[model samples]
Target: MNNDFKNNAIRGPINAFMFKVLSGYMDRLFGKSKRQLFRNHPETVVEIGSGTGANMRYLKPGTTLIAIEPNIHMHANLKKSADKYGINLEIKAIKGELIDLADNSCDFVVSTLVLCTVKSPEQCVKQIKRILKPSGTFIFIEHVKAQKNSILRWIQNIMHKPWHWFFEGCHTNRDTKQVLELAGFSSLKLVSYNLYSPFIPIVSQIRGRAIK
Candidate 1:
């Protein structure tokens, strides 16, 4: 196992359990948007940070889903969900910053709420672009920083440390939108919205696709 993977063993299981428990509620909050964005995804798609396979429900049965998940603890539940969904699941115990795919080898890549947790959002997005076939799209839904000078922003700043610690390095105020825009995609389309959930630190969210 990678050192990073081993180091996270203690917190990894706790995070995995939390995601498993909250998967249904999260789906309820983001299901519609996920369905809209995931519609007609290719037969084989790559998904970054596929925790507990929460997005599996949005994919068609028999779809080939290559899940990039670094946390070993999430794999068991993720596999269970894949079986339930009839997906052809391939698990890669790797981080998004260093994907092991060939250049232009993938047609589509998907991510949901992953950017905030990656060690380097820029490197992750770069890897996404590198592996995508020309004109291929990277679909994503990520929580971002609340507007500057807003009360919510203040709360995000205050809660940042604890949130990061509890969530295994998830940033409470990551500027994911900016990272995508600067990734040099051929074209990008994004929508910003608030998820009216109790998780206020992650309420400000964005979802869209960037074409390579």
Candidate 2:
């Protein structure tokens, strides 16, 4: 527990409410496409910044799971989520972009709403790409700057400060979709979208198969 109060306390409730909103619309939000992402579950799934295990419900059984979270304060909750779901979750108290995992060792790497806060998301993306075995996939669900209306952009910019104060480093203006692509995601399957009061706003889930 690295004392990420930004997540455990302040952002925690926000995260809970956001998930509650999504839990209701999960089917329509994924619309069978999530199945595609899970079809070839890797032997081990390395998830970066797995906050309080909100993703537990989506995990398939028997897969080895490793979660990277720097916030010591929120570690327990993340562990609890895994236990509740019967997931074999491993915790890395350090950053995900610098996972101790050997190069090309993991079959899959994932991140969920976790990238926006990374001090260096690009480096983390590179590390994810580097650690994944050849042809491995990186699955992610993250909030990014909207591609649709500019009003959303304006709103994000305006509320960005309060959002960060409440949720640690969460930013409302990152363009995560483009980041993944630029970081070398050749194939992309966007899973869902929705507007916001929560910056969980219309996320773009990336399930990219490494071409190298």
Best by TM-score: 1
Model 1 TM-score on a 0 to 1 scale: 0.96
In angstroms, how far off is 71's CA in candidate 2? 1.4
lDDT for 176 in candidate 1 is 90
- Writing each residue's lDDT as its tens digit, candidate 2 over 1-212 gives 22354447656667545544565465455535545655667667888887666566667766668888776555777777777778898888787557788888888777766788787788888888888877777877677786556676677777788876666577777877777778766565564465333334334234333442
**Residue 36 CA displacement from its true place in model 1, Å:** 0.4
TM values, all candidates:
0.96, 0.77
| lDDT tens digits, residue span 33-115, model 1 | 99999999999989999989999999999999999998889999999999999999999988888899999999999999889
Q: How well does model 2 score by local distance difference test?
A: 0.67
Name model 2 segments beyond 4 Å from true. 1-36, 186-212
